[model samples]
Every structure is written in structure tokens, then in C-alpha cells.
Target: GIFFLLLFIFLFQILYWSLKYFDINNDASLFIEDLEFQDKLSEAIDLHEIKKSQEPAFFNPNFISDYKGYALGLSNEEIDRLHQYRKAKKWIYSAHEFQKITLVSDSLLMKLSPLFKFPEWANKQKVIGAKTKQQQFSEKKNLNDINLATETELQRVYGIGEKLSNRIIRFRTRLGGFVSNQQLFHVYGLEDNVVKNLLAQYEVKGTTKISLIDINTASSKVIREFIYFDREAANGILRYRDSAGIIKSWSELEKIENFPLDKIEIIKLYLSL
Candidate 1:
């Protein structure tokens, strides 16, 4: 009983201190002052916050801030794609290339690209010894055969530069060579006007040399890998080939559902039997 009494006294002392420790202060200004002290301590911890209000207006889009990207209506995915693309040490030299990297829609490209403000040299076309677009063309012969032209020769075209010329040649190489002037339209960043100009200067005199796949025999993977045959179209082709027989002609391939009917002719260039 004496031990129990000592325990009660100890507990009472502990409870009193706990209650006093957590007692709500009635002095409102003290609470406010405590908050103000915390505010000052946070400011001292991160001084950069103090200068955030002094950030510049209208920074280059290449240096876009998160707030700027959000304000410009760029989705986080689009901004991330642009950043990932830029991480490759590549620069967006033109609006076309910017659109290619980010895959922003046409309306967005038009709205955003004008404000892009590419560096000055991007606008400057270098000529061996000339002042103007016409003079540059005059110095170089029109690119007659796109297949045989070097990157330097490709660059002679008004719109083609180092990056674009490499891209064109790389596409040409990938396809063995450009089979038609129309194929130039398929290069990622080439604009329609640029393609038209490319067509004017260059001709796809090289042979159409797409490595063909047998429609009846090739696996779905091979069929699907061809650009003309999307997954649905490829599956249809395989299903039809298995259910009916070898796709005897382009007409038969076209009859399959979602076969990209308009691209039938293009498909013919890649498939056989």
C-alpha cells in the first residue's frame, strides 16, 4: 500500500508536467511571432526563394522553366520528350526539328514555334561566296540525283543544312536509297515546302529496293515491322493468309479490314506473293 501510494504521487507529477507542456498559449501574438521566426529561419535556409521574384521575363524557350512550359500549354510529356531529345547533345535548329522531337501538333507548333527564337546562325545560310538564297543556288548545281548526292551536295538546297542534310541522307541510306520523290515526304523533320523544294532540286533516280517479305510465309512480326502494315493490318494479312490462302495480289491485301487502303500501292513495294 505504501509502494502504491508512492507510484500514484510519481504519476501525478508526470501528468501535471505533461499538461503544462501542452497547454495552449492564450497570447496570439506569441504564436504569430513563433510562425514569423519559422518563416525567417526557412528564408535563411534557402536564400534562392528571396530572388525568385526577380527572375527575368521572356527567357529563351530552349531554356524554358517549368512554369513557362506550363504557361505555353506544353504537356509534361512533351516537355520531357524535348528534354530527353536535347540530352543527346542535339540542338533544335528549326521549328520543324522542334516539332519532330516533341511531336507537338501542328496548331501547337504554329503557336509555339514563332516564339521559338532560334539562334542567329540557324537563319544564316552559308554560301561558298554569295549573299543570298539565289546566289547560293547559283553557286551549286541543282541536286539531280538524291541517291548519289553527298551531305554537302544536299545542303546546297535552300532549306537543307548540316542536321537536315544528314537526316535526309540517313533516311536515304536506311531505305537503300530514295525510290521516289514522294519518299522525301516521309523523312521526319522535312516540311512540305521543304520537300517540294527538295523534289525540285533532287530526283529519286535510284531504284526502289525495299527488301520484300512473302505475305503468305513471313511471320506477323516481319509483316508488322513494315511501315505500311500496322499491327491490325498485319494481323488481318496473316489471318487472311492462313484462313484463305497466299495473298495472290495487292487487291486481295487491300480487301483486308484496316489495311490502309490508300497505302496499298506503297504496301506493294514491300510485300510479295
Candidate 2:
């Protein structure tokens, strides 16, 4: 009886340790699966096809963070780090260095490897180094030579798309040629990633004429030039202005339903009266 009791206690001890160490509660597995799904879903969201109606869906960081956490078994700190990494280029070590990154796991690092490629190009170029082959090619393709180049010519640039090219041309017609690439970011529908990619490849020549687009007088086509305001949002802004009268101040934009804070902030820079 004494021997049997001792044997049972030994088995229980082993089970307890296994459960504790291995996280037998199943939370880890669930979290890892959730992160995988989030990654797949994110990839599936075609940034090109995304409309103003879809902006709300895309902007919800909480939803994205929560889903990612479940998929990757990430702690709050790990989730925050992931978002920071996405928003800006940051230090991302290898899977072996996961222990060094607080709250990050080796498995999570492996999963995120696809999104976190090292900036090899960034390293090669010094701050004052001569232009790279890509940069030279980009500079040679100037937007000012409209007689030679069409909308397709602009699209050849790393981040320039059909929508972006159209916006650029429209802005050029309104205010003249792009004096700076920073002005491209002011155009509606252009993503920050696109702007960053453009800045990496090309340097804008000359000074930008900082024209404040009058929200009251600006056409739908003109208003939609801002990247955040899709066709629907532009129409909504017009409709509200027509019905209620011109937006006297930026604060009046808050009255418009579904006008996201981030979008408002972006629009504020370009809007006047």
C-alpha cells in the first residue's frame, strides 16, 4: 500500500510539471492559430481594391491586434511591438534572438519573418552616397514631360498606381507640377507605404506650392484626391456641405458620421475654409 501511494504521487508530480511547463491549458495553441489566420486575412485584403466603405473595416487596430494576438499567442507587449514595426521600420532580430525581445517568442518570430525582411538597401546607401541605379532610373522618368509620358509613365514609379497617377496629374493641373514627393502623400488614396517607397527611390526637384484646397468649392474629384477620402467620403463631404452649408472650421467635420479621426487629421492639412 505504501509503495502504491508513493507511485501515484510520483505520477501526479510528473503530470503537474508537464501541464505547467508545456502550457497544457491549450491557450498557446489557440493564440498561435489566431496569429496565422490574421496574417492570411491581412494578405488577402487587396489594398488596391479597398474602397471608402472598406476604410472603417481596415482602420480598426483593436480588431487587428486582438486577432493577431490570438493567432500568434502574443502578449500585449509583443502585439504593441508588432504594430510599431508595421507603422515604421524598427529593430527586428532573428528567431534565435526571441529571448532577447521581451514578450516575443521564437515561434512568433518565425511567423512574422515574412513581413520583417531586413532593409538591405537601406544599409548599403550612406546618407550622402551617390544615387543608386533605381534612383537614377526614377529621376530620368520625370512627371513634367507629360508630352512624352502618359499616366502609365507615372505608374512606373515604385508606389504610383492608376489612382495615384490620376491624382498626381489632377494636382499638377490645379497647382502645377510636383515640386516635392511629400505633396504626393497629401493626395487621397495614396498609402503611407507608397509614399515611403517613393521617397526611397526618388528625390523631388524644386519647391512645392502648398495650396490649401477649399473644401467648400473643391469638386468631388478634387476632394477625393486626398488618400483617406474615397469616393463615398468625398461625396459625403460634398453632400453635407451642400445641405448644411460650407464647413467654416475643421471642428465641423466631426459632425459627419464615420469620418475617422486619422482621416480627419490627414484631410485637415490639405483643407482650407
Candidate 3:
């Protein structure tokens, strides 16, 4: 009986080894990953659908903020390029024009262009608003509209060459349009005679109101950006403001070493108490 049991165990072991060697599934895939493929594909499709359904309502291409630009998938460099272009008193009115300035990818343009809602007038080549001097007045247009004065109008002033006129315009732009004709003194290369010539022809009359900076509260950076204030002068003002809060009067500026004592009267025009 023991011998027969041993012989039966040996036969069973031989049978198991033979079956394992001949197994048809040995060369085939261990498991089907294709089963999970449909689930992943469905998940991706649902995400795409959700994004499409939740599209933003309205955005003015004219004023895309940093966050807005980021949400719209714009790179920092691309957004900055658009801002720099706009800072020079230019506007982005259309999808093509926006793409031209920002230079976004073609795929991104396609995605964002459909959402662009520009001002109605942007559709036309030239907007109807803000007519030029030529359009607003007749050929003999001699008015002291220095803020609205074109290069040609500026050239009409004696001693103001193309360079001088352009310089004046640039100064005006940097100051967000001049507050007073006295601001022309900020223009470089302008001789006393040329300034008198400019004064005779022009004064600061514009459509935009000047927003004065509160020297007491303003930062060094804000003061530095001022047309007349050099970096040292701006920093000095900030130091004074920090040490002694709520500057009561311009007389306190006398103590600040780098303060522009010469331009105090003119600087007063753009500073609040």
C-alpha cells in the first residue's frame, strides 16, 4: 500500500509539470491594459467638456489684467509685450492685432480669439471718438491746446524743431498728459528762449485731469517716476517721509539734501498736501 501511494504522488507531480510547460497563456499578455484605456479616455473627454461649458462670460481685449492674461494661458513675456505696446498710447482692437502684438501661439490665439469682446468702434479702421486738431478745427487752428497739440502744431512755435517737439510730446506722455504748460520745462534740450517760444504758442489744456501724488504717502518708486524728480531726489523725499510722517508743507523739503529746491514751485503743481 505504501509503495502504491508513493507511485501515485510521483505520477501527479509529473502531470502538474507537464501541464505548466504546455500552458497556452504563457506567451500571451499577462493582463489586458486595454480595459483601463476606455476609462482614462472618458475621463479626459469629460474634463474637456467641463472646461468648454464653463467658458468666461466677457472680457475686454483693451484691458487684460495680469491674472486675466494668465488664466487665458498667456506667458508673462507675451503679456508684457502687449502692455509695452499699449503704454505708447496704442490699442489692441481685434484678435489679429492682439496676436500680432502679444505673439501668442496659434493654438492659443484660436482658443482666446473667440472670447475677445472689443469696443464697438474697434471694428472700424479708425474709431469715431477723439478727433485730431485737423478734424476738430479749421486749418488756422491756433489754440493753446498743448496737451492735444500735434507735432505740426508744436513745430509752428519758433525754435521748436522736430526733435524738440517730439521731446515735448514724449514728456507729456510720460506725465500722463501735462498738468500745466510749466511742465514743458521738464523737457530736455529746451533753451530758455525755446521755452518762451513754446509758452507763447501753447498752454496745458487737455481732456484728461492730472492725478497729483501725495508726497507724504507716496513711495520712493512713485516719486521717482515723477517727471522732474531725479532718483536721488525721489529717494530723499521717501526717506524724509518715512522719518517724519505727514509732511505739512513744502518748506520741509529744504532739509532733504537731494531735494530740487529750484523746481519746488513746478513740483508743487503735481503734489498734494
Candidate 4:
């Protein structure tokens, strides 16, 4: 009877061990499946679309907090440390500074480097006092003919604000230059009347070999010079051409209101067709 009881106890121990092992295996499998499911769901989300969404739910503080928590799994202390580090350094610091910092990882540094201030260690390092003299000289130099000058040069023109300076630079890049005083209308914030007032003051020699009237496919600048059209009108013509297809004939100019008969006649001598 004693031997039978011992044999029974041994069998019971074996059964209990097997059941525990099976339970552990099942739990592990379940955990793996859950992880995979979450990964798939994360990949399915369109991050760009979510970022662009108009609703506060997409960009609100609460959503951002949840998103950071899910993606980084950073502790509150770690997050606070990162914030403190960022605050101590200028927002515009260079990538080198990021690399030098021991607390920041290479991947994280690369991601954050673009937002930081360019370090004083960067090339062409200029002293503050030295820069003032150079800037004064540059401004003095820019007071010369603006038509021949670069955007940086144009900034020196008296009464030209930062916004206006940027506009001039952009216009120069797009259309090449202010051909006629009329072309200034293409610049943002420069009102037509203001342009008309300023046109006589600034003289621009047209250097573009492609005359407005010469080509079947005229650029925005050519169209501007041809019809004395504003930026809006030039854009309208381009949009119309794109939508309806190419301009088949000069007579098609009639369809565009800004292209008057007299202007068309004046431009006919210069056109291809």
C-alpha cells in the first residue's frame, strides 16, 4: 500500500509540472501575437495624414503626449532631462554640438540637430563687432544700381524692409528681373499703384534674350512684359494653358481679359506665330 501511495504522488508531481510548462508556453505565444498585432496597426496609420488633419484631436497636447509615450516609452525623468538639455542650448546650434553631448544618442542627435542653432564653431565665424562694420559696408555698397544687384544686394536699398527684400529676391529668381516698372506687380506686397510710383525711380535693362512676343510658349516673365500683366494675370494665363492645353494661336489671347487687342498688336511683332 505504501509503495502504491508513493507511485501515485510521483505521477501527480509529473502532471503538475507538465501543466505549468504548457501554461507558460501558451502565455508566451499570446504575448508574441499581441506584439505583432500592435506592430501591424502602427504601420497602418498614415502619420502624414494625421499630422495634417485640421482637428485639434490630431495635434492637441494630449494626443502628442500619448504619441510620444507610445513611440519612445521614455520615463518622465528622461523626458524632463531631454527638455532641460534643449533649453540650455540655443535652438539653432550645429550638429557637432549634438554629437559632442554624451546624453544624446546618434540617431536622436541627427533627428534634433536641424532645429538647433548653428554653433559658433561653424565656418566663417564672424565677431559681432566685425560683422557690424561689414554689414554697414555691404549696405553702403547696395545703394548702387539694384537691377544689377543680387537679392542680398537689394536688401541695402533704402526703405526696403525684410519682407520686401525677400520678395524682390524671389521675383528675381523666378522672372530674372524687373524688366519694366510694370513687372514689379509680380512681387508680393508690392501694390500695382506702388509699383507704378516706383517704376520711374528704378531703371531695369531687360537682359532676357527670349522676348515675350517671340515664343509660342512664353514664360511668366515674357507674358508679364508682353501684356504689362500683373503676377495674378500671368499666373491665370499659365493656369488656363495648363488646364485647357497649350496656346494654339495669338488670337487665343482674346480669351484672357488682361491681354487687350492693342497689347496683342504690340506683342505680335515679337511672337513666333
The top-ranked prediction according to lDDT is 3
lDDT tens string, model 1, 1-273?
999999999999999988776665545435565778899899886777667756544334555555777898889998998777655644565677778887889999888775666543333312112267685466345557778889998888888899999998777765556665556766779887787677667776655456777888898777777655668887887788878886775546646877764344445665678
Which whole-number lDDT from 0 to 100 does residue 100 have in model 3? 92
lDDT of each: 0.69, 0.59, 0.76, 0.52
**Against the correct fold, how does model 2 do in TM-score?**
0.32
Q: For candidate 4, lDDT tens digit of each residue in 17-135?
A: 99999999999988675778788788767665677674332221111133463354434654555445544632212345334533546776565444443322222132223357766
Candidate 4 TM-score, C-alpha based: 0.30
Look at candidate 2 and tell me the lDDT of residue 89: 28
Error of 2 at 85 (Å): 5.9
Q: Model 1: clashing residue pairs?
A: none
Model 3 lDDT per residue over 55-144, tens place: 777676756778989988999999899878866757676788888999899999998888887643354324323357776454225657
Name the 10 consecutive residues with the lowest summed lDDT in model 4. Answer: 57-66
Question: CA shift at 19, candidate 2, in angstroms?
Answer: 77
Which sections of candidate 3 miss by over 4 Å? 1-142, 206-208
TM-score for every candidate vs. truth? 0.43, 0.32, 0.44, 0.30
Winner by TM-score? 3
